[model samples]
Every structure is written in C-alpha cells, then in structure tokens.
Target: MKTRLVTASVLLAALGVTAAPPPVSAASLPPVSASSPPAPAGEHGWVTSTLRHMSLEQKVGQLFATYVYGADATAPSAADRAANRAAFGVETPAEVIERYHLGGVCYFSWSHNLNDPGQIATLSNGLQRAALDDGSKGRVPLLISTDQEQGVVLRMPAPAAQFPGAMALGAARSAGAARTAARVTGRELAAVGIRQPYAPIADVNVDPANPVIGVRSFGADPALVAGLTAAQVLGFQDDAGVTAVAKHFPGHGDTGTDSHTNLPVIDHTREEWDRVDAPPFRRAIAAGVESIMTAHIVVPALDPSGDPATLSPRILTGVLRGELGFRGVVVTDALNMAAVRQRYGDERVPVLALKAGADQLLMPPDLRLARDAVLRAVADGELTERRVDESVRRILTMKYRQGLARAPFVDVDEAVRTVGAPAHLAAVTRVTDATLTAVRNDAGLLPLPRADRSVLVTGWDTAAFAPVATVAASFTARGARTTARPATLPSDQAIADTAAAAAAHDLTVVLVNKAWDTEVGDPRASQQRLVAALLATGRPVVVVAVRDPYDIAHLPGVDTYLATYSYTRAAMDTLVRALHGELSPRGRLPVTIPTADGTGVLHPYGHGLTW
Candidate 1:
C-alpha cells in the first residue's frame, strides 16, 4: 500500500487501450449524470439576479476566501489591528473582504480569529454586516468557514464541546453518533454565524502510514466510511443548516507524504480507486454535501499527467464533476500547499484550479495575486466569463440554499450560551462513551477500585486536550490517590524517570501517542521503549493511546490497552468514566491496526473487548 506507482498511461497506451478512467458506471456506486443543476428557486431570485450585474473583478473576488489574523471584523484594538495588517496587509478581515469584494472568509486559531464563543459570534456578526453592506450591492452573504473537524482539527478548541473525530465515530458504528456530532458541531458554528465547517472527511484511510489523514478518516472500510460520511453530511446541512465540505477529494488516504510539505502520489487503478477510495465521496455527493475540497496529491491513474488533482482538469472536471455529478461548490484545499505551490506559484494556482473546475480558492498565498490572476485569465481567453459565472452561480446558490441569504447574523448573547452548552456536551459525552475501544485487558485492571487504589498516570504529552493534570484530577475526584507526570519526548532520561515513578503506585496507567507520518515505519520508537520500561516493572500497566490507534501494534507486551481516538475534553472525560466503570468499552476498531512495519494486520477491524 505504501509503494511507488507504475505509469498507468504507459501501460494502457502500449496495450492500445484508452488511458481514461474505466467507465465509472462499472463501479459499485454508479456515476450520477453530469447534468446541469436546476435554475435558482423563487427564494433564490436574488442569487440569479445578483449574478447578472456582477463585474469581472467582483465575480473573481467571490471565488476566494482567505484567512486574516485578527479578533475583530474591524480592528477595535491596536494589537488586533496590527495583527490584521501584518497578516493580510489590512486592518481587519472586514477590510480584506471589502478590498477584494471577497465572497467568503475562513477562521483559524493560529490567526487569532477564535478565542471565545462571544468573541467569535461578535466577529462573525461584524464581518457579515460588513460583507452584506459591500458584497454584490448587499444582496449576498459571505460564506464563513473553518476546519472544525473536532478530533484532530478544531479551529475553536475550548468551550466548544468537541467530540471524538471520524475514526472514533466509525468505531462506534452508529450513524446516530456521527449525525449527533455533526449536528452539534454544525449548529454551534451556525450559532456563531459561520455557515461552513470544512468537515465530514470522506477520505478512507487504507494506508496506515498516511501522514495527513489518519484519525480524520472514518475507517479503512469504504462502505462503512461511505455510510458514516453521508450521515454527517445530512446532519450538517439538513439538520444544522451548516454547509458541510467532504474533503481531500479523490482520496488523500494512501499517501505517505503530507501535501502541506510534499506531493504524494496514489497509484490506485480505476477499479481499486472506486473500491477503496471513491465510495465515501460518492456517498457524500449523493447525500448532497455542499462542497468537496480537492486534494493536492497527484493521481497518475486518474490522469496520466503529473499535475496534482487541484490543478488537473482531468480529475476535477472529468472525474469528480462528470463521473460523480457533484454540482455543488468545489473547494480547493489551501492553494498555498506545497503540492500545488511547489511548481504553480500564487499567480497560476487559482486560475488553474478555476479552469480545472474548482468553484472556490481557499487560503491562497496572496489574495491580490490569486484574484488578479483569475481576472486576467478571463480577459486573455484562458478562461471564459461563462466559466467564472458558472462557479459564482454555484457559490451563490449554496449560500442561499443554506438560508445565509435570509438571516445572515446570529444573536451574540445566545451564541455565547449555545456553543459548548450543557445539552451539547451531554450528547457529546454519550457519543464519546461509545467510542472507547478496549482492545486488551489481560490483567483485568480496568474498572479499578475507586477508593482503595493509588494510581499513577504518566505518559507523553501530545498537546491535544484534557491535560494530564486534569486526567489525574478526574481520578482523584473518584477517590483514588493519583500522581500525574506527563512528558513530550521519550529520551532515555525521561523514560527511566517515568518508569521509576511507576514503582510507587498500586496501578500504572500510561499514555502512548503517535501521529501518522511519512517515516512511520517506527514513528514512536522512543515511546514504545518507554512503554516497555513501564512494563519492565512487572506490575499491571494499562496503556492508553490518545491520538492514533496504531500504537498498540508495536506494544505487544502491554497487558491492558485502550484507545480514545482523540484527546478532546469529551473523550478524556468519557475515558475517565469508562476506567471507573461508569460505562463499558463498547467501541469496535474502525481501521485495522497494521504492524509498525506495515507488513501485517496486528489487530483486525471491529476487534474490541468490553468489561
């Protein structure tokens, strides 16, 4: 699964066979007809009428949604204002939208765009007011978006009622869990006036060594992943009114390289691609997912050209648009990524993506370069005005369908209380309980005596969530005397010290975390050594993998194993309760745990133990 690709075009061309993708109808999920979407509805009369009056520059502007670094829509403070100028050469995101007449904005924690629910709500309202005031003669609303995928990617982390991510939901094998999480997440975002959350990751992670899409993917089984993806899609749009984006199109699942850094290649032939990768996307489109984000990886089998999918017309126009019949917005994954940027600079990427059939350009390196390039492309006949209108119509249609056209603002006070509300967290807690997978309990150490035990909790700090002190406090509140020691690296000194500390406790519960990486042959060798050191004490040791589930594959000596899938507050809280017998370890394995060397399956999918 982690090997180089043979040239499909060279082989097929020599055989005198067409190098195009096999007839998509031959696939399990038959291709939907690539017919034109119906005209805008009566409620969407504004969308159609507004598009008719748009200038070339305005239409080009609507295709982009860039990130800005400020807490305010209009910078109210010197610090916030300076952040905006430094990041985007503007005083606020509002100014960015106005300067470009941009149709959308994206938020990220690194950009200081999210702090608290009230702040997010205020900024969103202010931005929307500004957008509505300036965009298309105030007829259109900005499509605000963020990568709030919850488990591994969450723009608003704290006080947001985060849940265990896709793989965890897949392990639960409950469409109810996926729908509940999506509805909760989407409603919270909508409450903040953010209409889009780039979520419901449709990539099926069949390769254990994939660097970017491990826990984000639902699982390795395409059929199961497809069903869950559709559930989240429906939940986000129909139930919550938030636009759900099925991401990393054509599957970024089997790559060893991170597209943010390097271009990875997937060599799956048409049949293999349909079986292992295309199901979730087909299901998402069938579920009426509002957007599909393109991957930056090159798929030689899909198109023999070396162009990345984001820049390949064959993949985007021919495969996704034609074979999949996705008439919704096509989102291009951050245009500044290495796979797209390494060759195509800021100027060429956006125009190429547009010509390739993408409707939106996200996070381009330079807003001026990207928007201007598309405008020039149209003027020079590289792209036609009709093509630009086609994309803008799609974008406007999505915004109107989501009710962003009718009511584009959220109540600040209500948004403050709605995000991370008690009801939402309660639902999240119940779902989190279902995602706890107990793979091994040979010593039956779980459900430990609450009052009598002196437990030691120590392990690598992944810097995800629910810090070790919080976990230890949870144990302490349960009447156990708990000592917490959390570390980052597993140097010899760190491992020896933690192992020695394990000797003082009646029970040792250590956490081992490892992220998917290109060099994943032994991604956590030092962490594995630390676990071995703890087991060397000859005491009952319970190992909890808080990030990716593949940690257990390399730690065969451990007598107890648990996977929380994510370290969100909800997950950690539920995990503490599960350890105390408040709930059972009921989640099954979503993806098979392959050996560290990627040579064999150490734990098959759906394998789990319950107390």
Candidate 2:
C-alpha cells in the first residue's frame, strides 16, 4: 500500500499536477511579458510590472520554491552511480523551467556530478539558461539554493571544499577565521551558479540532547554565536558576493527532538527568547543578511495557539517583520519535513504559509497543488493580489541585489582555483592551531617522548585516520616504530585490545570522536568505557576529542583532555603538532562541560583559550 502511494506521488510530481483545479484553467493564464516596462526605482520595478500583467494563477505560482529529488527521466544503459543525473535527463532542467514556472530549485549533491567539476559547471549553466529562457520577463534569474553547511552536512564531496563544523569555529574564537571560512565556502558555491547558501547556522547550542544541531551550531553562548554568525554572513555576502541565509529562526538550538522526524516544541518563555535565543538572528539581520529561514519548532509562549512559527503570522509578521524589522526575504524550512506535513496536508500548507507572511514556501510536497491553491486564494480575494506582489518584490529585489539579474554565469575556472586554495588552507590551519585546547593535564601527560616510547591509539573513525597515517609515516622516517590498530571488540574488548597493544608501549593516546544525539552512530559511551579500560592498564591515557568538548565530563578518569573540536586533516595535524610540543595548545573550551555526572552542563558561549 505504501509503495503504491509513493508511486502515485512520484507520478503526480512528474506530471506537475497533484490535485484537481478550479474551472478556470491555469494553462489559459497570460505569461509575464518580456516587453513589460520597468517600474520606478526603489519600488522593485520588475515585480510591480510582472504582478500587474500576471493572472491570479501566475501570481500564485511565483510564491513557491518546490523540491525536485534526483531527476525526471533515466539515461539509456548508463551504469552511472550519479543518481541525480542518471534519473533526470539533461532536458529535465528545461522541463522544470517551462512546466511549473518555478521560482527556485534546491539542488542535492546526488543531482550533479561532484567528481567532474566541468560537468557540474555545464549542468549549472544549462539550468540557469533554461530558467530565464522559459520566462516572459528575461531579466529575473531563478534562485538556486543549497544546504552546504560543511563537515558532516556537506552536499558536494571530493571536488568541493569541506570545512570543519561550527563547533570548531567557535573553539577557534576568532570572528576573522569564521569569515574566511565562509568566504571560501561561498566562492565554491557561487562558482556553480548557486547564489544562495543556507548556512552559518545561528542556533546557539543550548541542549546537548538536541538530536539535530550539536556540532552544527557555533556554541551555547548567544553573544559568541551572534558574533560568529555575523562574521560568516559578511564573508559570504560582502566578501564572496553570495546570498547567506541565517536559518532555523527563532532558533533550533534548544530543542531536544529532530524536526526531520517529528515536531519539536521549544517551551522557553518570551523573556528567555529575547535574552538568549533571538540575539544571533538579530545580529545576522543587522549584518545585512539576504534571507532568514524559519524553524519548524513550535513556541507556545511566542504564539499561544499551537501554530508552528513557519506558518504563524504572530511570529513571522509580528515578531520578525514588525519587531526585529527584517526587510529581506523570509524562506520556510522544507515544508515536506514531518513537522509541517504531518499536521497539515501538502495542499493547505501554501495558503497557510502565505497568509502567515512567508515570502517563499520551500520544498513543498506538491508544487502544482501549492501553486493552484495560492492562485485560487488570490482569485477569491482570500490572499490579496497586493500580498502576492509584496512577496514577488522581495524575491526579485534579492535577485537584483545578488547581481544575478545582470551576470548569470560566473568564471568556473576562477571559482575552482579559489576554493580551498593556499590562503584558505592556511586560514583553516591557523584557526585549528589557535583552538586546540588542553583542558586538563595532570602529571604532564602531553608532549610525549620522541624516541623509545611506543604509542597505542584507539577510538575515532578509522576513515579519518588517513592524516594519522601521514603522521605515522613521518614517525617511521624518524626511525620510531609506531603501530596503530583498531580495537575490533566492544568497548571492554576494545579496552582489552588497547591494553594488549600498550603492553609493550609507554603511552596510550585515545583519539575519541564524542558521540552526541545530533549525529548518527556516536560512540560516546563506547569511548568512555574504552578510556576507562585503557586507564585501568596503568598506562598514561591522553584523550583527544575531535568533535564536542562535552565528553570531558563523561570520561573524567583520563588525566589529560585535548579538544581539537573537529576531525579535519588540518585539525588532526595541528593536534599531532601540539602533542609533539611543536606548538602550544592555545584553545580554551568555547562551551562549558559539566564537572559532575548529569550536573546539567552550562556553556555560557564565549569561552576559548589563549596561548
């Protein structure tokens, strides 16, 4: 039954019509003309003219930015693993442009070939041209957006440059470092005709139990989160000339549940929100952010009625528009997520969101249903024609501001050359070096012996140990026997394996990637148990955390704790350098770790160590 429903949905999506429409056919609607004269300056000339000429149906279609997964048609006999390209033919790009008159598209990594940079570039150019060519007004460029938040949440791998997660940036404690990272990220995205990056997550990491936003957020401090978010926005917009969207507003930092699977309600009071949660968003807006993506979480204090902020006029219009005074575009988190879809069917979401003051409805399940619903509402005077114009104006204003209307194509070679170049790599190195912290070092466990001292390493993903291999190679060059083995047993077994490995070694260096609810397959408990077992061997245990610093409190038995905050190659090298006494551990704990077991950890945001 589920398979049948899914097949129907896929078919309906392919046809671009999911529901029955009113008697007046949308097909009969007039096209927004290319020859339409522009309106006065500062008043969004194209939007005004386009709105005036657009039928009720066309006006409604402008408000939706729908989702297209993989592609439409399959290639002939291509055994390619690039599902996006294989499933969707090259002509599929042109089809989306002509059929839905789509305002924008969210591209997944699987949709384009990441390994072939040239092919990706070609595909991007074709998409842009298709969007403009099908439109009545040739000037309005389509909004191309992506969720490339770096680290584990990265969309494009290999050829596209990947940076450490937000926790690492917070640990670095330098706004300049964050900005440089964002600038490089933006440059890579902009190279492929992707103008908007849904990034620099401003969510302050308040809940360690939060299933989705652990390392994704900067830290738990409002002030530090605000500063880092602003720097990142500036880097993407001012420095790199790409649109930066500060997301999950009012804030997804405090929630314990994941919105992808369920509706997570933030029960904080209005006072608490104003004091802590709202600052980073306010700061980002002040920094001239191009867009703000609404969170799916419900805050009853903000709105007594149980409407999620994504579809709440009280939150979107009253707070964000009226109080905070954000004049830029406001996008909704993917409406297809369970948080929105489970409550309201896909058809009702467009009307509710538009009435709630959202400028764009992102990733709606059925674009045609949403488009038709909005059209019917406008025609019946439920959603005013002026309201449609207002949203269209903001969308166009953003496009113009992004210089997308003027120069659609970027220099692909220049973008590839600039992405993760020498200067960017150096910036990453400096930040990692500055942020490597030695939280506790009893009896001087660090600065291990260069000669005649065997080292037993365990924990962390072995895949991330490629750089460690290089380090081991260098040790081999220095005539030191360094044997690293993965403990295949359970935590206790792993400990036994480590003890066996360390029987002939002087020190046991356990590299632990702390498991948190936010990530998949976090081995926090296993790591803790392994650390305990390794300590039982009477060997000095130096534990290095490559993710969060919260694990320090979990594994207290280990005398020395090193927080690198990320497992990037550069970060790992920096960690190794600190261990060898080549550089001092200068980083401080950016977020606090609780001293007692279950003491309720409090990370007041701006903590970082200085050499």
Candidate 3:
C-alpha cells in the first residue's frame, strides 16, 4: 500500500477556494518578523500555508474556542458524553475538537473541566494528541485557554497562588507588581499546557456601581489602568511564554449592569470614550498584547448600531483594529452571554460576531448551531472561504509563534511541581502585604493598644470569613483571643445576633461585602445594620471591606476601616500582620469611596493611612 499526500494546490482547486479579504486592514497588520512578538511580523509562512490547504469545516473549527462538559478528554463518562452531545453534538471533548476542528477550548469549573492541575495537564495533552495524532489532515496545536485572573475570577481551584487581585494591584500602584503577578500566574498556566489566560482586564473602571467589573478592573484612572495592563501583558507573554488577553474592549468599566445577565449601553461620547475607556486598551496594544476579548456591552460612541462590541464591526474592526492598529486575533466574549444570545439567538450570533470582526467565537450557547450556521454561510457564499482563511491565519500564526507547533505536550510532573508551589504562594503574601490599605484610623486606634485583648471578627459570606479565620489565627499568635464567625446571610436577625455577640468582645472587626445586586439603595442592608449595632456597643469597631472596597460607602458610622480588595488567602494572612503593626499598611485607594448617600467622596482614589 502506498501513502498519498494531497498538495496545497489540489486541496484549493478541489474546494474552489479563493483567498478572502482578511478582516484586519493592511495598515493594521505590519510586516511579520520572527523577532516581532507584538505583531505577527512575517505571517509565519507556515500559518498561511497550513491555512490554505485546510478543509472548510477545519477552517471553521479554527474560529471557535468552545466549552464542553467533560473532565477527561480521552476517557469521558456517560454523563460527560451525554452533556457534550447536547451542547456540542459530540460525545467527548477530543471528539468535539476533532469534529469542530476547534482552534481552542475554554475551561470552566462548572463544566468539570478543571479539578486539579495534574488532571488539567492530562486533559490538555490528550486534546493535543487527538487533534494531531488522531489521523486528522491539516491538524494544528490546540490553544488551551481559561479565565485565570487570579483573585476573584479564577477558574482553577485553590493552592493556585491566590493574590489580592487587580484593584489591589492598582492600589499598590506598581506596574512591576502587576507584571510579577501575571508572570506567576502564567508560569502555573503554561506548566499545565494552557497557553492563554483571559486577563489583565483593560477596562478602566469608572463607574463605582459597576457590578460586573468592580475589582476585576485595575482602577478608575485610565493612565493607572493602562500602565498595569501593559505590564501584565508583558509579564504573561514575553516572560512566561503565555498569551495575555486584554479585555472587555472599548471598556465595560462604566456600566452599572452586568453583560453576563443583560446588555449594557455605555453612553460615553466619542471624546469621553477616548479619554476614559480607550486608554488601557490602547496601551495594551502598544505593549504587544496578542489577544483582546470583546465586550458584550454597547458603546454608542464607537458604534451607533446599538450592537454590542462583540458583534459590531464599527467597534471591533473599525475602532479596535483600524483606530488602535491592532492586527492580532480578536476573540469575542462568550457568544452565549445574554447580551449577544437573547437577540440573535444561538445560530445567528456566531456568524454576526465573525462578520463583525471577531476571529474566534467563544462559548457559543450551542456549538452545533454556531458551527453549522458558519459552515452553511460559507457554502452559500454568504461568507467567503477566503474570510475563514483570514481568521485561521491569525489563529494559526498565534499557535506557531507561541511555539505550540514545536512543543504541544507538557510534563504532568512539572505541572504538579510548579502550580501553587511554595515560591508562588510566598510571592502572593509579599504582593498582598503591599495592598493592605487603611482609609480610616479614628482615635489612633490601629495597631490596637494591646494584642492580648478579646476580638470578634464577623462577616456574612463564607469565602470572605474563611480568610478571617486565618487572620484570627494570626491574631491568636499574638496572645489575642479572637472569634471568627460567618453569617453568610444578610437577614435582619442574623445581623442582630452577630452584633449582640460583638458586644462581648473588647474589639469587634466587621468584614463586609457587596453581598448581592440591587437596582437601588444598599446592596447589603443587614450588614450595614449590623455595623451600626456593633458601633452602639461602645466598643472599638473595625471594618474590613473584603470583596469590593466600596462596601464602606454603605457603612457610615464605622470608625476604623481597611480594604483588602479580595478574600484570597494571601490577603487574609497579610491583613492580620497589618492589623497588629507587624507590617505597614501600604495600599492606596484604587477607586474612591462615596458618601453613604452617594453625594461626596469619603475617600479619594489616592487615600490611605499609616501607623
């Protein structure tokens, strides 16, 4: 038997394919160079050549990075197979990748895709083996991606070197620190064969009430956010050999609504948008960030079509590509998000997003609906095969440039050794120690008069209080009798009982968060009442806003306040050290805290106190 190899010319002629105009303009895509990490300078002839011979279905797969319900790619259970079939029309993740000719796969905790570092490494390597070794023609390395933004939006579970998060980095105001954190995060990710991390959020968080991007954003100041975003991009890409995605393009920082639930319309005038929202993204592009995730929110100033940025040519192609001069891959936010899905439905949204300038359609609600629609569109000439090739060029260029072509497999032992190891976790403490801020120190009460006193620390959420217990342990080291308890509910009775308990201790520490979303008024009324009741006890009360620093705006009467910006373990360990004057509180406010009635600034963006 003789093995026959099909030539590129034969493949193109058989498919009747002509080169389609690439989505990005010539001005946007500079000459490619092996040295140019910022731009795919030389187009890596391999990428374009490989893209040319790819089948239409294979090329379409390169445009999607989807979610599938499975932990094991090679040995999926019956439940995983059924769930994957319902969502992807495939029985296993490897099968779905082979079926879709997928460019990437996004991992989610709920999808059971991430359990531990070792398991994820096995799955990632298995997916690569399926795509390349499973006898597929014109195969490419898989782009394994996930949201590992560290602090609040981490996809991988614990022992993963948790930090105090983006706002905390912004509070510390060190681009070097931001870069270090991204480097640490990327080290762990690359160890597991995951190449891309959707992080270093470029959205300049201007709206205090933004439910979606609160602590995820660096800060409200565009310059501050831009500096950190660029640092992070460099850290992840240049230092760690992983791609860092600057996201929700055109900014999701000013919206009060969350795009995960519904569409948000940003009303920034063109000039206002340029001044407020565009800076971080622009800086990110300048920093050579290869990927940018589109926002599901509408920016009327950029695109008057009322289309979300994810499905808007004016914003994605015109503004992001043409204006910002971005030539790299443009990945849309989850196509299944309510903002894009509700109006366009499952089938039509992927095509619109791609037509609107997205290179990769992420997390389409139904993979079959999205995959088939694009396949049909191309076959009908509704979309040109050339267009599909253009996107695949960008995708393949990324894989090849990142050296995924040469080394697609990872050592599972190395992954287990590197992720969440002592060195990474120790860095977390050093980073978080710099992020602890004291906005109010009434009566010079901090470093508390004595450490051998009774202290009661209370919070209504389990995650926030989990760290309080650790902080209490640190307090106990100082001969302090500390009580750490969680309400995990904002009921009036729970607040009253917690406050009553607070009266028994000489020092009462209240940990509060923005518990839930509300259209108006306080988001956590019971936490506020509990604070007020704690104050009435005539004992010294300390309040810490563990989630969002804005929790202080709702508690008007608290005398001493601190902002940890996140409930991550490193932050908790540092908090106790800061409380007892072991380490100085160094963090400044990243976002201003408004007065209780939202009338005036209680603590400005740069406010922080010392011992």
Q: What is the C-alpha RMSD of each candidate to the true structure, in Å?
A: 7.3, 11.1, 11.7
lDDT of 1 at 182: 88
Cα lDDT for residue 564, candidate 2: 74
lDDT per residue as tens, model 2, 187-266: 77777667788898989776655667877888767777888898888888887778899988889977767898888888
lDDT of 3 by residue, 498-588 (tens): 7788889988877777732323465466677778888998889988888788777667677798988888777877887788888899998
Q: Which scores higher on TM-score, 2 or 3? A: 3
On lDDT, the stronger of 1 and 2 is 1
Off by over 4 Å in 3: 1-43, 463-465, 515-523
Look at candidate 1 and give me any clashing residue pairs.
none
Candidate 1 lands at a TM-score of 0.91
Instruction: Identify the candidate with maximal lDDT.
Output: 1
The lowest-lDDT stretch of 10 consecutive residues in candidate 2 is 1-10
- Clashing residue pairs in candidate 2 (N, C-alpha, C atoms within 3 angstroms): 221-605, 588-609
Supply the TM-score for candidate 2.
0.83
Record all residue pairs in model 3 with backbone atoms less than 3 Å apart, i.e. clashing: 20-386, 31-41, 32-41, 32-42, 33-41, 33-42, 460-488
Relative to the true structure, how large is the alpha-carbon lDDT of every model? 0.79, 0.67, 0.79
